[model samples]
Target: MASDKSTASLTTASSKAILLLVVFLLTHTLSFSQTTTRTYLVRLRDKVSSPYSVSRPEQFLSQRSIQRRQKQNIAVLERDLPVNPAYVTQLQQAGAKVRFTSRWLNAVLIEATDATMTAVQRLPFVTGLEFNRALSRPVRSGGRLGAETDTKFGQVQTAINYGTSQTQITQLGVDNMHAAGFRGEGILIGVLDSGFMNADEVSFLKPLFDEKRILATYDFVKKETSVYEDDSHGTSCLAAIAATADGQLYGTAFKASFVLLRTEDADSEQQVEEANWLFGAEYADSAGVDVISSSLGYTTFDDPSQNYTYANMDGKTALCTRAAQIASETGMVVVVAAGNEGSNAWRYISAPSDAAGVLCIAAVNQTGQWASFSSIGPAADGRVKPDLAARGQGTIIGNPDGRIASGNGTSFATPLVAGLAAGFWQANSRLTAVQVVEALRRSGTQAGAPDAQLGYGIPNFARPLATEEPMAPFVVFPNPFSDGEPLTIDWQTINANASVDATLADLTGRTVWQYRYQPGKLGTLTVPSLNLSAGFYVMTIVSGDKRRVIKLLKR
Candidate 1:
């Protein structure tokens, strides 16, 4: 009987050992699976209601933000609320490592194994899921990415010389606006791009730093605080707007305050970057920015399956475009690059540019001709896109290394236009964001006849500042005269002794032609055409304190 009990005990020990080994193997397999988990974008259907209230917007919005909305008659809606904390907890409970959350899209990015993802999808709040690529590798220190390069470093000079930037700013009449003391003072601008490498160290941007105009910065790509350590594209874009030095170089809105945001992942092109852009824009809105300048556009991605077709250029199709529209509705003027795809296969304006009510900028050369690489557009809905054009080809930029160099892309044009828009708005403080946009469109050389290639044509900042008088009714026929055609002006002179003076100036406000005449009782005056270049010209008609500015396009 003792021998039988010993045999039973040995059998029990052997069975227990086998059971422990099986459990260890299963635990190791589960650990391996978790480590190999993939990242995904999980969209939630709704958020928990307990923690947030749309009526109490002060909790989420700054005082300036609240003031801006009040001025524009915009309401703080439920969409502006932060994502519910309960929903995030639920996602975390499902073994999802949350990376980012977008209140605008009501979505959260998570990392989880396939089995865990399956479980996450089965949750009641989960509406859908998509595979998001792994985080892009961080750029190596001092490495150049995209169109930014460090070759121009060490070439910076101390004296003020305008350099190659003069042509770009002068062509848009931005210099005249500067002369009027409207250099973006009292205005806040948000610059959204990949990175802002060396911006703090550049000489031209020293004023922005010295005056503490860089109000805030955030990096959405790496989820870090160091935007100056990444790509230099943002540096170039900012230089186009806020870089200022005595005579050497000056940006369009040199005196404006700034909020620098790193929204793009320069290492990779993906849809996730668009979400980052949306988040950045929302942040900008909450900070009370008057304008947003975004050089990034989307259509193609590293994953071909995630690429957007031309059909998606519809104003609301692209997620970023919807965000831009919302931004416009929220009272901030948004400017975007029309795109540099003119020479590529997908030759159309990219999204956010297609968004309605936003100013889409196209690239033009110093000669005021459209750049070959500037994307063309009639948005999918048939609205003429690229509301304006700016000098982009060979645009001078203050590089990260303190050197001033030239770069080419619509990316440069967007900020040039954005800065000038700020100055224009500064000149007329009473103009709403929508009114300013309309004024810009009307100030374009081609306002009378807009086309897809150049949209309304290049904008003239000075033209928008002209205040109209109700005294005399003046009209110019065949206004967009050819180089050799005659211009006929008819006006109802309020006073018989009133002298009529006509001046034709280039975009720089330089008087190219001037004439003085006394209108007859018939109220008609015809001037023979003089030699003029094929470009945009401002025709200012002044008759005894009643002045009118007419934007003319010469063929």
Candidate 2:
């Protein structure tokens, strides 16, 4: 009994000592100025019951979002529901001004005075509170975008003349993917960054505006709808994915749609921006976005007390990392920059990039060599980070001032991979978001032997598409078979004498239809109708000893 008491006392003393050490470090580092208002991450105990229901998700989720989840076999759980309104109202009544609420984390970001926070803590529903930062006026953090350069690399062409952007585009075989007609059509990408300065007026990107492809824009920092008035960093990042200028510049997924979100604040390096990112992620998820491409990363904060150490890069420590993981889990491909800290004292990848579910991209030059400034990593937990590399060094980008220019940073590399992912996903529309991430990694140049510097190395977009279907010897046209249209199966490669046996099954593996036929005569088979419901199905075909399984999406 005495020994048990002693152990408990020792543990208590050690925790207190650790808490004191933290206080001392905060006091010695950057001190906070006297401020009346402070922002906090308020954790709630329970979601309780809300106006939304899991049975009727359309009340809270978009129709497209519901379909994505349905196709992925992901359930609509209580966690997907919004926070209890009564809880938020109670917090507001307690003098805490709500900034944003995260359904995934079941928390609220609120700005409140010390006395108001004390009152908020007394609320029965309040579980805990984490101080984010003081609500002080912003001080500009010197522009953090990749440095623009005058030197340009040599260009090469294939089916499309990319001009200055050819090397970067071809390095990843994105041009070949484009040649195959998968130019990211129907894919919706959400870009969360600092801001898009002149994206609204940029010449190469004007087509997106004119075509109504710029679906939405939101500024989280300023809490506004216009994202065209802030930093130019986001504009350049967008150009790396969606810009289109014949012989001068061409983005990898130029035909895809986009949602512009300003989640980063160029004027400050604070933890609140992470909260803003979480908000952006939730918005992207709710908007039925297929991909999230974020060029922003976080490491050190203006308030030193909130700075992260290398130990914090464990994929689960930071809020943004957790949010990125959740976003991936919700069936969105999360792509992030590996950061430009390779030469800095803290030479490592940043949060969100460290997230396991996210595809972190490193930077390589036009020559396919690792860029010196591209952040390196074996995530603190020992997982190979920067799952892929792309041309970022002297890569062509569109300037906010409407000029085509070259820049160097993993920021550019990220969107290059993001665009490729958009196009790749367009080609493999039946694959889940997680499968798309894995397919990209498998298509990497060094996929057989990955490393920290370049991870799996630069991806080859054309390789996977070719390898995935070469042995099948068959093709399905109008794959996501539209209603009132015939589903056609053409076999042009297999021997005419081969016997074909095909079976179609629902996602649950129950066979719905089967057909036995000889391709020797017609070489094609047309089914007028299968009368399938709107969801994903699997079709297995066996020609002699060879077997092939194809995923089919029925709409």
Candidate 3:
């Protein structure tokens, strides 16, 4: 009895130490100054529910209840088989490269390469070859439509302004629309998460529920109607862009409706957990939900056999991708986490998020540098990913309880953008999902071109500018010129015969002056010397295929 007591005491101490570690980490991360709210995860103690009297695992997690029924083996042979230190040896014996090995999953996802996929069928114990994919992301909204109306739920928590600078998440193209009064009034967001606590008590959410905003909720793990306890991760994610309080955590869309789908199984590590997510999305779709943003992605599994490798991050390898794809096609804008594997060996975004057409978001720091943990991409298909950026690193978060905290992860960044998109849709309710995405993409600060690291850079809150637009030209010394200096117009382009596409306009797009571009064969063209006015003016060089718009300034 003494030994057992000692063991239990030691376990308790260990748990406490872990809890302290969590607090320490969160305390040290950078948080945005903006008062916003979202829910988040904390290392929590397990409160055990007594085991079933009978072997009725079906009571809560049966195939029908949880939708995690065991699936038939379908992965190709190359991905099967264990890989250890002897991975090379195993590959050498098989006459294959060692690249197939996935150290994290302790298994290999080999490729046939020159070998036909049919070769995999002949291999012993080999299942069918399955393709992996990333999920699709949502399109951007144009702008805000109105102020959020007071609801029975009182002031709900929102964290929209939390991390646009960090993660560079810009898919929320029309986030300003939320401020304009489009709060996803008729839309529904399904949160397939671990648990919920104090969700019923938030004031802003009361009106939504009272007005039947909460369509439905289901607990896949417990198969219950209530999921309002224990988990704070989903709540935090939801708050990133959806929560709203007058002075507290403000969501991009303070009035968006939500449905909590407790599909994640925090206790277990298996393929079935992924299956649960599919079921949750399916349920949400059937309920006519408008948008789905899941801050979850899977590549590595505790069990070696079920793990995915870097190459498997083709956006289609996992079950999650299959469902995420379907959700998007159904017209529900889907935004998925880009994964936090920046430091991991197989550090690329995982499935569903890697799926084609999904706008993956990478986390960034305040200075616009890539967040160390933001998932890397150039998806296996060779497409640059993280369609855009948003604040993600060390973002402030709200929990299931009315408590506020800060966190860092693609998980948090995703919802911030999602909420913004919801707000956009609310602003232009007539906009289709694809239209929303295009507006957001075009509205990007770097929409003219995109690459892997920071897909489209950060977003501009105003109307999205285009590369082809025509404007005026000006020569301002010390570009981004300081105030009070004679805005110098020294240039070969400003030669007597040369003409500058000199036309200035205000924010409202009214042409202040128009100076036509004169054809010139010279290497450079300069407009006539002139003192330029400031307060944001566009100076354009209108040469065919050479359209450059430079900003000017004056004292």
Candidate 4:
């Protein structure tokens, strides 16, 4: 069953996926208990009212919806793409009937023919059009799973990415909590992946099982009596994310409980396979998953008719889109793998990963260079994707036979980050889903500025959430400074040759005051004592290494 991880020279990790698959079938393992399953009631509020109106649903993406709408008349369009609310306005103005509107995509997914499509394209502000063929019947892929050790489910790794050889997976942050012995005990995590055959038998996950932390696992793929029998991918993915050993490989969130969902169907191409993920995500919500980490994304399939062109990659183009959106709104941290189609002409991050609100992940090698297999992003809507990274190729995780295998893929990278997320969650359960997202982004290497390839850059838990006092003293004061009497900005000591610029800016493009200071200066820069109207102002210090911005109110 173990095949080389090569697929058309597709990229690295192809060989690794196979060897892990083979080791999976060879090991016979113990089973997991089916007792613990947390259920969450998924509630959707009215869109125009309440918190749901402003930030109810996060809009973190857009991609792919550019394909020519399929001309064939199909009944699913009603369920596929709902009528646009704005289109109703367009139709009424054009002397057409306005009946119903779509609250979802904010545009009408009309049942247009070739002529209608052409006419609609000519309409004003019609950003894009799509076929809405996403509503396919659900089909089980394959899920071979079993229970493993849950003993160390309480031990969380303090590092962002812990590699093999007992070294922290990342270089930047410090693991203060792990060092303090609070490694996420009693937290439950749900992992949705391909399959898990021998993962339960592996000794790595044995501790968690013994500790009774692995709540419950269901295989949506087979709709089976157990999730520990059909595939190896899910098991392997989970192992890397949460596995623990006796001075062996360490996981990110070792203490978190896990719910495993088998969504990918490596068997055949049917639009429903994509829909199955929707159902799985719904199930995940029902399962009360604190965190949902899926390394799955969709693009092309076996059926040419079902093939998704790059234009259709917009987060709104697929059935998985809504499901992913719903998952995010429900407050479950959703982490998805950016696809590995980077080198291919069809390469781009896949759907759901392109979905709004969830954190899309990219892969990076040990040397900190972007991996060639890691998909590039800027979702269809131009939002930076791959919000973070972890080790992919050469990432070491435990095998069922009590050994380790170095693997690769945005898949592996995803689990590693997911595990890190678990650790973050463990460190602070009071953190809301959005707050957690902000903290992760703010703690990244590229926090101040982000790009398409690595959204906010790598997630660093230690720095953003650190509890210790600042190493260098700094101050911003007199918030709500009335008429700018005198806004004093204090300076602090810093490294050699460091300089700072203190400036005050008004709402417009005008600068009120700008002052530069040397590294060791211990003085305050006063804003021009001008009688300004009530408004918002920005005071900032641009230092040699870092620039700090503080918002001031000019009352």
lDDT of 1 by residue, 339-419 (tens): 888887978999889999899999888899999888898898899897899988877777888877778888988899999
- Residue 266 error for model 1, in Å? 1.1
The total number of steric clashes, by the backbone 3 Å criterion, in model 3 comes to: 78
Best by TM-score: 2
Arranged by TM-score with the best first, the candidates are: 2, 1, 4, 3
TM-score of each: 0.76, 0.79, 0.56, 0.58
* Local lDDT at 45 for model 3: 17
**Model 4, C-alpha of 66: deviation from truth (Å):** 38
Q: Please, what are the lDDT tens digits per residue for candidate 3 over residues 421-506?
A: 67655544445565566656656656768877667765543452343544445344544443344334433433455455656554
The C-alpha RMSD of each candidate to the native structure, in angstroms, is 10.2, 10.7, 19.7, 18.3
List, residue by residue over 50-158, the lDDT tens digit for candidate 4.
2222221122111111111111111122223323344455544643333223333343323333334445456665655334332233344222111123222222343
- Looking at model 2, the pairs that clash are none
The model with the greatest lDDT is: 2
Off by over 4 Å in 2: 1-35, 131-145, 150-158, 464-555
lDDT of 1: 0.80
Q: Which 10-residue span in candidate 3 carries the lowest summed lDDT?
A: 141-150
436-543, model 2: which lDDT tens digit per residue?
Answer: 898789779898899999999888765523323446457777765656897787766555788888888764467889988765745576666877665456677677
Model 1 weakest lDDT span, ten residues long:
137-146
Q: Residue 323 in model 3: shift from native, Å?
A: 1.2
